[model samples]
Target: MPDNARRPGTDSTDRVDRTDRAALRADCASCFGLCCVALTLTRSADFAINKEAGKPCRNLQEDFRCGIHTDLRTQGFPGCTVYDCFGAGQKVSRETFDGQDWRQAPQTAQQMFQVFPVMRQLHELLWYLTEALSLDAAHPLHGEIRRGLDETDRLTRLPADAFTDLDVAAHRDDVAGLLLRTSELVRATVPRRKKRDHRGADLIGARLKGADLRGADLRGAYLIAADLTGADLRLADLIGADFRDAQLSGADLTGSLFLTQAQLNAARGDAATKLPSSLSRPTHWDR
Candidate 1:
């Protein structure tokens, strides 16, 4: 199964306009609660109970809103807070299905559930491609990034039936290649000596407090519960890095690459945690 959904970020150095990213952020108010029903919930720290795919959560109201929206963490459903469908939920609900919700048209439920995930992957790629195009450092590959963005956007608009046969993995690989180049170009601005490569490393619970990790390649690194207090991570490539329960207090991530709001939502941080202007501080951080 695919991982939960997410979104993108931008900053002052971004070349792309912020208004163009409206379709990349989740709009729950315009959705049909697809995430609540389409995703399987395991009985873990993230969820209060197990829920099978296509089955609505017990907390789902008739209006397609979570009943415990304000108290999700207190109700043991913190996982719901970090999930971002990258605006795929509404696209699937309104565009793909013509706004016909599962409750009204039970026959469409199965197909909608299957297509939702595929649409999400396409949308996630769009998020990354959009962010890549925004970075001034990636200007050398702007043409290629734009092409990838256009292609991914086209894929997202494909007919729902076309999704079943779509080779998303291949497309993702193609996009990943472009993003890798983007990461390299952006991180190169930092001094060669300061560039730390920890790609795919197992650093769970590692003590990295106040560490100088500027321009580090931390892709797919396992940083669960790691201490990153006051760490300097400017311009680091954090794509696919697991920051769950990790400490980000006072960490400087102003120019971090591929650092999404979902990642920040999963980790612990405080008011002093510096972030890119494009990303917002998680409300839970204050609590």
Candidate 2:
């Protein structure tokens, strides 16, 4: 193996930018592991040991190597596998800084790590735009998606030095608005909505357990405080939709389109229910 590992499992999770899956995997391999050095997490289900931002884990060996990667789950570090670097991480580490190791820069590592999250947000927008273009039903939103993609691409080229000053949450909200439009266009033909557009509708406190929501368009819809236990969400386009405070227990979300683990993590769900393979049930939901 090369000093940099490139296993099939090693490909950066770029589903947010679901274009050219193979190229996206290469984009991940091209990264210098900004995630490993930039992020900090306390010991928990996801991470076996506490790691501070800018401080490399004891298991992270020299030359960007992980000492127990193959045995991460057994070694109690399965959380690493669940995290996605979105392609910006390695680029900022290598391309932005010209391959200067964070360990060497020392003073700049924290700022670089901080920027990793910002870049991930931009890349996620790029991912959403790319996927929107791939949808034949969403032709009406093509121009908008292109515009968003162009802007997000520019975000990727920002100076790493400026990342520390970025307001990423606000930027994410802006792009999220357009992504919502694209989702509506894509699901316009789905039969579930009837004449009622659920766009931005509040479905909170509804009794929807075991409902078949297949092929539904749920862009930015508020599902808070809803009981969705056992609801079938297969093939539902759920971009920017709120699942917060929703009971997804026994909800069948298999094959649901465009749903990320981050979205699921922020929601409440049950263990007997199915979820995207990438996410585990929240501890609160396991009870």
Each model's Cα RMSD:
5.5, 7.2
Per-prediction TM-score to the true structure, in the order listed: 0.92, 0.67
Q: Candidate 1 lDDT, tens digit per residue, 100-198?
A: 999999998999999999999988888888889889999999999888887787676677889889999999999999999999999889876464889
Name the lDDT value of residue 141 in candidate 1. 100
Best by TM-score: 1
lDDT of 2 by residue, 1-287 (tens): 12232323333432223345232221434455666667887898668888888777888766677778667767887667556555566657665666676677777677777777777777666656766677777787777776666666666666777777777788778777776666666556666555434557789778888987876777678887788888988757777677766888889887565676556755678677787553356554554
Looking at candidate 2, the ten consecutive residues that score lowest on lDDT are 1-10
Report residue 72 deviation for candidate 2 (angstroms): 1.7
lDDT of all predictions: 0.87, 0.66
- Give residue 242's error in model 2 in angstroms: 9.9
Candidate 2 residue pairs that clash: 16-127, 17-127, 31-90, 32-90, 230-250
Minimal lDDT window, size 10, model 1: 1-10
